[model samples]
Target: MNPLYSPTAERADNRCEYCHAPELVFNDLFKVEHIVPVSHGGSDNTDNLALACRSCNKYKADFQTGTDPDTQTTTRLFHPRQDEWSQHFRYEEEIGEVQGRTPVGRATSDRLQMNRAAQIAARRLWMQLDLFP
Candidate 1:
């Protein structure tokens, strides 16, 4: 593991910064990811890192902008370091889905595939175990 990984996971409460799911619920350890791509001149500093699941990390890749499904507007993705999660997203525990409340949120949510079936199934189990949102 990268030495920086432990602290990044700790800082993110062992949850995915984007999906907000606990690492314990996943089969593999969560990924320590660059919130901004190193290819984009992003740094490896702790401030530029976020804990993410394999799914989110793979889906997000290096892109930070997408069209908002709700508005069809091109917008910047939600910056876990800069944007407040609650301000942009709302967790619907009943449906086990993260609802994006804003354009940026919706774009991020859609691009990240936050509501994919595999994720929802895992979240359902986590909720039952009292380890989820």
Candidate 2:
């Protein structure tokens, strides 16, 4: 890892801050991503960094906000350093889905495919093994 990139995996408990997927489950190590992109003037400060899965990092890119498909409105995505995860998303064990509790959550979910098939399957397995909440 680059010196500029802190080990956010430890801070995030080996989880992707965006999707909460365990970094250990991925084929390779997760990325240390900027909460805001450098192209967008985001800095290299650790406070602005997050551990991210390739899927979430690639999907999020430089976007800080996203469109809510259900409402057709633009809303801010969840901020790992600033926003409370539980305030926006709740893990539904019954369906193994990350349910959006607010517009921000909903938009973030849609933009990042948080409830995509693969993630849902992973969540189900994680839940069964007592690895997920």
Candidate 3:
């Protein structure tokens, strides 16, 4: 493991930062994610680290910006270090889509592909377990 890498178990209170699923109980591997990726000149520091599930981490790899598939407009992704998740996204239970209230939110959702089918499925399961809102 990279010395700069804090264990996911420790970083996120054992939960996925994005979906809030308890990784200890989910049986899926978790990863230490850089809020700003190293490739983008992000530093390896506590403030820049977050815990993410393998799926979310992989989907978000190396992306600092995203194109809204709907509008075809390019926008910067949300910066976890500087932005609050709730400010950028809201979960819609009926549609299982993460609605973006701002450009940053929309871009982050698009870049991370946060509304992907698999994520929706997982979120549905988590909701069933009363683990998701």
Candidate 4:
């Protein structure tokens, strides 16, 4: 496990900082990921780290920016430490989907594939269990 896992996870309230997926439902601990990858010249500073789910981490990889589906313009992914969840994204309970409210949110949602069918299915289940937002 990453040495920063405990503190990062705690700071994120045991949820993926990007997708807001609760860690409690997963068998594996959520990853402590770089908000900006080292390959992109990011440091290991706490502010640069975020807790991420397997899917989000995998999809995000080393990229920091993505094309906003709506604007068709490049935008940075949501910065957990700098951006507020409510300001960027909203959870639609009826559909178990997360809707982006800003460019960063939209790009992050698309880059991370947050609304994939599997994610929606799991979100619905988590909602039923009252474990999701």
In the range 16-81, model 4's lDDT, one tens digit per residue, is 998889999999999989988999998999999999999999999999999899989999999998
Clashing pairs in 3: none
Q: How accurate locally, in lDDT, is each candidate? A: 0.90, 0.86, 0.75, 0.93
Per-prediction CA RMSD (Å): 1.0, 1.4, 2.4, 0.7
For candidate 1, give the lDDT of residue 66. 74
Per residue, candidate 3 scores C-alpha lDDT tens digits across 85-124 of: 7887798999777778888777777777788888888788
- TM-scores, in order shown? 0.95, 0.92, 0.81, 0.98
lDDT of 4 at 120: 99
Model 1 segments beyond 4 Å from truth? Answer: none
Clashes of each: 0, 0, 0, 0
Which regions of candidate 3 fall more than 4 Å away from where they truly are? Answer: 1-11, 69-71
Pairing residues by index, what is the TM-score of model 1?
A: 0.95
What lDDT is reached at residue 6 by model 3? 52
Worst 10 residues of 3 by lDDT: 2-11
Judge candidate 4 against the unseen true structure and give its global Cα lDDT, from 0 to 1: 0.93
| Top-lDDT structure, candidate number | 4
lDDT of 1 at 127: 92
Candidate order, TM-score descending: 4, 1, 2, 3
Write model 2 residue lDDT over 47-124, tens digit each, in one string: 889988888998999898998877989998888999999999998889988878889998998898898898899989
Model 1 agreement with the true structure over 12-99: per-residue lDDT tens digits: 9999999898898678888989988999999999889999989889999999897799789999988988899999999889989987
